[model samples]
Target: MQTSTMRKARYLLLAFSSVILTTGLGGCSVSSILKKGQAEQKISVVPQVLEVNGENVLFEVKAQIPKELIQKKPVYSIDLVYNYGPKMVEPIGKMRFSTGEFIYENDKPTITRQYSFKYTPEKSRGKLLATPHVAKVNKAGKRGKTTEIASGVITTSKLVVKSNTVSLAPDDYRKGVSEPQTLTFFFDEGQAKLRDYLGTNMGVLKELIESNYKTTLVEITAGHSPEDADSKEFRLPLRRAQALEKYYKHELDVKSYTNSSKSVKFRVMPVVRNWDRFLKQVQLSALSPDQINEILTIVNSNVSFKEKERQLAKLDSYEYLQLYVYPTLRYADVRITYEIPQKKDSEIYLLSKKIVENRIDSDKLTEEELRYSATLTPLLSEKLKIYQAAAENTMKWQAFNNLGVTYIQLAQQALKPEIREKLLKEAIINLTYASHRNPTAQLFYNLGSAHHIQGNYLEALRSYDYAIKLGGRVEMLQQVFADKAALEIEIGQLDDAVTSLAYAAPGYQTLMNKALLYTLKGNYQDSKTFYEEALALKPNDALAHYCLAVIAARTNQENDLALHLRKATQLEKNLTAKAIDDPEFRAYVKTPVFREAVK
Candidate 1:
């Protein structure tokens, strides 16, 4: 009985141990399942460094999740953000994968997406981060680990050239000025003789000659009444013109005005069958519009001049025309063009300088002279001072416009941001004032440039459009289009840029922009060609050389890359740091030669 009891105890102990072991094994299995569910993911970003194209920062992201990472009821997604500054983050975009849509059983779950965000200067030094999450349907997701996918934006596209067009006021400082004087003499119908009463009209001509004003030309236009049959001979008008010429010569000789008339050129224009003068006089008379139109219709008809005259004679208003207009037409219209002396350029320039320096009265130089003086100096500071003085003294729109443009030019040359800003502000103020006075194409164009430099892109574009709307000289319009195209390139309007450039004149800026366009389009050969052409125009152009270096780096021409980079750095030392940070030379950055060349 004791042996049987001991056997039952042994069997109960063995069964209890087996149950505990089975429970431990089941717990291990659950822990293994949980570990498998939380597998690690791989995320990759193309252009590991972000790039700014036009006005936007652009990049791409790809995520790979292991199979079984997402359970039947769970969804997978990634949230992206651009961290530029402390407490500053820009939301990029999100990518989500639902359980049913992605089959983890067949293959690893993979997703690739493109992302972009508007770029700002503050966001240039930034990183792009992506965080993954797993969630149940219709519930908050558990956040996975966040990872940085891209860094530091490339802002090479923002280096577009700013070509501002400035407007300068014209000066009335001509070396020689021409003045015209008119003298009229009337004659009877069919007669070509100088009347005694006509001599009175020569007094003004005599005074003009006596004043020592050089008589450059003496033009006599003689007309005869068409009603007289002798007028149709065409000799009558010539004879009338000769009579005036003879009288003019007699006056020149008798009055001893021969010195001023020595070089005078006499031209006799006769009106015989032509009805233009008669019609013009008739139109100015108290005739009705209907009568004028009737006369115009006959005169403009495809008929003989005599036939038109016959038709005119049939009109009811013919009698009035013969009395009022015909007599006026049958007279010598003598026009004497004379030259008036003007100060030499050197003298005018000296007077302008004296006026600016307060050495002479401001009235010594005209308002135009004050404004034009700014253009004679090569120094921008001098120009600025002159324009300011002109604006203050003249209070003219042209002076203000020139002053504003000068301010803009000075701002462009300023090295300090604060100074540039101050100058640009002054420029805007003066330009705005000028616009209120009288808006011109040049003023609007300079305004656009100021706005462009200030980063007011929309306002700049509007100003540029306004400049285009206000038409100007062909050269000025071409410059405007070229500058507008440069702005378009900075904003990612490549197609629009191409169209804008079509109307641009061929110049250094236009060629450089074309090269930049070709570079963006991946036409490296054409881009290189254009860069070469641009360099030819401006041999020491640092930007053009740097662009060539970029092309060389892209094309894997190591020697050319080093050559251009060296040239660029020699011309502009700032390019050395730029090249070191530029991704265009990323592949060569690790190489010893690149380091040596950059150094």
Candidate 2:
């Protein structure tokens, strides 16, 4: 009975298969296999990757999985990989699909996934390539080999950085009255013509003559040593003075007159005596006190200038006097006076802005204007642009130096390490160029800042020393010393820091920096004094109050400490967190007062 039933079932199954094949072959439709041109696939991304905000690169992938495949419930996975050059030290960023928790809806029948990944460049400016790999999942919940669905090239443009250029103080902006610059020309024993040694002095005089001034007063004073006081020799000194005056009027093209005139004044005074000078030399020498007194008595007596000189020469110390004292006495003193026209504060401010803006024509703006403009602008970016423009326009050392300084400022502001390194290199190039063009104190000072930023402490110190030696504008000098002091403090060179800070101006920031340096050196008393001084300059300074609080806490001044800490926290709320971890308040950390203040 069982065998008969099995044969019947087999016959029935065969009949069923035969009927289905016949129907399918006869053009009946089936939903299991995907038809040609039925499946749709597309990959697209807006913006690729250029101009990505922050670190994220967002892309949308849209596709329509064929309805036939949807019936099979096919699963797909998308993977993204970032190509950063040939080698990547680490992955750029992570990527995430919109959602994969829910099943693909047959009604919807679309494979839509919003893909996102964070991107970071290896350099300041570099290419970033992102490729998306897509694969289908088998029934076993395992992913098959992936095929690159889409790819994009993300580019990063160069990033640069800077601080604002600060304007000069009101007093510094105004030009003060010019004091007379004197140039002395020494003659070689009766020789009145120009000497090889006098060329430098003469050139200086020429420069003064050519400078723009309201008016120039040329005062020539003729002086001769006691030896040349006689009628024949006395006239030679006046003749020599006249010769120099002639050189000034003719060779240097200086406007002047032979005698006292509206612009120039020529004074021919009596020949000067060296008797008093001779007495001083004798006193300083190894000569006995008695001998020196005797020489002075003879020199100071009421005698003719020539007679006094003869008596002084008769002394044992006369040889030293002949070489040192006499040569200095026989010289023509040329005093040139000119008035530096005072500029209004507004004018300087405008000029400085113009220079930084590079709005003024190159032909119209002077080098001084460009240099001063670099110092006066309040915005660092503007300052950098202006210095670059000025350097190109003027091709001067001052412009180059200012440009280097601007680069250093930019480096300070840069967010990326690679970008900062590039900016510092640019600074070094400009600074070296500046030194070659004209090694000004300001140039060395800027170089110092660059070196310091790069961790070249020794080079920074050398540059700072050179800057101080060169002696730039007083304001720049102050800033340079202040910066030097800051470096010294960083290196634990406390005494040097003190010396360096001594040269800085007595400003609020400078005082605060000094206080910090002293505090680092464990001189709480000195630090307290400087912090108080800083507060006097800037009453509402949060940093000043914060530092004072630290000092007060260290010194066991509990009441003052609480007062200042509260004030600091009130002024700047961020200080509360910093104070919580600061070791300076270690003594007070366990106290309720400290906890309350920080909390």
Candidate 3:
């Protein structure tokens, strides 16, 4: 009985030990499953580095979760954030997966997502991170450790040079002005003779020739009355023209004027049987429209000239024509064109200087004269002073507009920020005032430039749009479009920028921006072509060489990359550090060629 009881106790102890061992094994199996799920999770980012498009930073991420993890937890979530500068973070996007929503029959769950966020200067250097969360159904989830998927934002698109279109008001300043004087002499019917009293009419012509001014041309047109019977022979008009020419030579002593250095050119046109002058005089008479049309119809008919005149004389308006028009047609018409002397450029400049200095009355020079004198000198300071005087004295829109444009030009040459800012501010004020007064396309274009330089991008865009809407000269609009395209590229409107650039004039900036657009689109071939064109226009452009180097590195042309990088660094020393930090060159950062070129 004692032996049987000891054997039963041993059996009972063995059964309890087996139960404890089996429970511990199950616990170990559960821990192993969790560890395997954690180890199998995979995340990948395309491009590996974020890039800016238009006005936003964009990127793509693909997450692969193990089936084991999905099976253990009914819900999965991934949170994306862009972290930059001193712990600042921007939540870009989020992705969620649930067991009921997604099927995982025979494959691991994979999710790919694209993310974007508004790009600011602060976010230029930043990293994109992703955090995974696993949760049980109807329970709070546990968050996984955050990992960085992408580093740094590539902002090559922002390198586009800003094009400012400035406009200056035109000036009506001429070196010499032309003054014309007309003299008329009347003769009796059928008489191609000069009247004695008509000699007085030649006084003004002689006075002009005798004066210091030049007589450039003298034209005499002599015609005979259509009623004359000898009009057909056409000798009467010739005789009349000769009579006037003779009187001009003898009575007016025109030969002396022709012999002088300030000589005059004389042309005599004779009108015979031709009814042009008679018809013109008739049209100017007190005749009715019907009478005028009747006369024109008769004159334009396919009949002999005399027959047409006979038909015109048979009309009821014939009496009015003979009394009022025939006398005027039977005379000589003289027109003298002379040049009025003008002040020299130096004299105008001195007068403008005196006006600006308050040494002389502003009224001494006309408003246009003052504006024109500003252009006589190549100095911007002198122009500024002249324009200021014109603006203050006249308060004209042209003066104000020109002054604003000058301010913008000065701002471009200013090296100090404060001075540039002040000049730009003044430009804006003056442009705004001018725009309100005139609202011209040129004024709006100038306003856009002022705003662009001051870093007021939205305002600049608004002004540019206004300038385009209010159409200007073709050249001005082309420049406006180019400038608008540059702004569009900076704001992330790639397609719109392309369209804008189509109408833009081709230049270094325009071509360079086109190259940049192609680079953003991954068309390296087209990008390289445009970059080459732009470099041809401005070979010393360091930024252009650096851009070419970036393309060479991306295409794996190590030799070209080294060559371009060397040139870029030599031209702009600061670009060496830039290339080293650039993500486009990340793949070649440690290579000897890259290191040597940058060095």
Candidate 4:
């Protein structure tokens, strides 16, 4: 009976709860209140895709807050996610804003932001998309970490980037090699005027100017020997330079270079005592190394320049220095800088004929044209005739040297032994005259080449050494070393030949020669290493490929040997015969692939 009473009480309580549900608390529940509050607060995102300039892509987006949300005083942050390429997606830079920072008008807030990647102007190659997200700040004055709402893709653009092409040509194809020549004019004691030898050197200088496409600058610097009085040292050099400048302007009547663009510049260098030359003389003298060191220590002290000079003057060996060094420092040096542009074969022929015929128009003929025509004409006879005329007219050292070069070329190309001998003799005579006119490194180098061809090995080596000493003009130093090494090899001085190439320029040609030398010494591994280095420097070098093919054959690398041999013969047809007879390829000569490759 007690259990039944408890059951009856529970049913009455349930009936009361049903009445409360049927009735209304303003006809709304707890969930309905939350939903209504959310509906009242409104925030949205506006998206845009824009092209900035012609090449840049920009993603512009804005956050909009209605008056209702602003009145609610809620803070929010704007965030963006973007894609740079088809497969490249990353978060755009972090961006946040509060209602207070936005421009407010009539209780509404507006805020904007932008993001950019890079520009590509060639092909449409990439995609860019930006999606914005918004988060509300809580009452705690901290941003809510969650992204409550997000906008659609704000920007999408394709990328276009152009490709660049590069080109490489061998050094052998390079034309218009520029060489620097020095002109020295000596002066008597207290004399700043030109000397008799100046006429000869000046003629050479004028010829050089007339031979270039553009005479850039003529630097005339004068300096005095240390023997002059301290007060006179600076004054004498300045006076000498001023006199030379005056001579160039008033006496020489060279208005074109002076008036053109101030191409002729004059400067007075400080009085040069040739102290380095003095040191060399001291070393060569009977003085001991300790004595030389002591002298240098005094000369190189931190004392004043005058005090150092006084110390040098007080040295016991000053008399020997006076005799060897002082005389050479009293001079003016002329440095001519000019450009020589490359010319076509037809242009060279036309210019050569014009030069030989004496019909070259000074106004129309460029210095490079005159130079190329006189030097690079195809026919040796034409070059000889042009240079012969140039020699007769200018009577310059360069003219004779060029004439000799033409003869040397003619001799090299001549088929008949007697004609070759005669041409070689003529070259020798002309070059000897050139040496007398100007003892330049280039002159001696040419003479060395001529003597080497004539089988005078010792004379050739001596000339080569002298040329190397004087070859401070340009990039010709390495070529001289290369030629000297070739001469050394001819005389069977293999070790000296290798030593001679120590200073050879790091180029494909020199590296290839080094590879050959190593191969001759039974160093196939080292030979292969150097050959690979040469090929890396110049991929299109046929000789490097041929040499590498030879090395591969010797090492029993059949595949590499065949591949390189085929490539070498393909690049240079004449290499086919060379590959056939090369003792290095003797083993490969019988291989079917090697036979087919050479064929």
TM-score of each: 0.55, 0.39, 0.53, 0.42
Stretches > 4 Å off in candidate 1? 1-39, 46-49, 67-77, 85-88, 94-113, 132-146, 168-396, 399-403, 406-410, 413-426, 429-433
Question: Positional deviation of 347 in candidate 3, in angstroms?
Answer: 19
Considering summed lDDT, which 10 consecutive residues are worst modelled in model 4? Answer: 160-169
Error of 2 at 409 (Å): 4.5
- Clash counts per candidate, in order, are 0, 7, 4, 7
- Report the candidate with higher TM-score, 2 versus 3: 3
Clashes of 3: 4
- What TM-score does prediction 2 earn? 0.39
Which pairs clash inside model 3? 54-491, 54-492, 55-491, 55-492
After superposition, candidate 2 runs with Cα above 4 Å error? 1-395, 409-421, 452-456, 473-475
**Candidate that scores best on lDDT:** 3
All models: lDDT?
A: 0.73, 0.57, 0.75, 0.57
Model 4 sits at a Cα RMSD from the real structure of 31.3
Q: How do the residues 323-395 of candidate 4 rate in per-residue lDDT, one tens digit apiece?
A: 4344445667776555545667676658657767878743244433444455454666776886676566556
**Per-residue lDDT of model 3, residues 1-599, tens digit only:** 99999999999998887776444423223344334445676778876787887677777777766664454344566788889977799987776665553445349777777778888777877888887765566766567778888888888888887668687876645556775656666677788766644222343344334443456677888887777454655677778778777666563354354334335567888876777766666554434568789989998899997788789889987875664566666777778776544677788889999998899998777666788899989999999999999888766667888999999899889999899999999989888766655544577878888988787778888887766644455567678888888888887788878877876777998899999889878899999999999999999999889999988987999999999999999999999988887888989999999999988
Any runs in candidate 3 off by more than 4 Å, and if so which? 1-38, 68-76, 98-106, 133-143, 165-433, 451-462, 492-499
State the lDDT of candidate 1 residue by residue for 249-354, as single tens digits: 6666666454433567889998777777776666555455687889899888999877877898999778756745666666788898766455556776787778
Clashing pairs in 2: 161-410, 163-380, 164-379, 164-380, 165-377, 165-378, 165-379
Model 1, global lDDT: 0.73
Rank order by TM-score, top first?
Answer: 1, 3, 4, 2
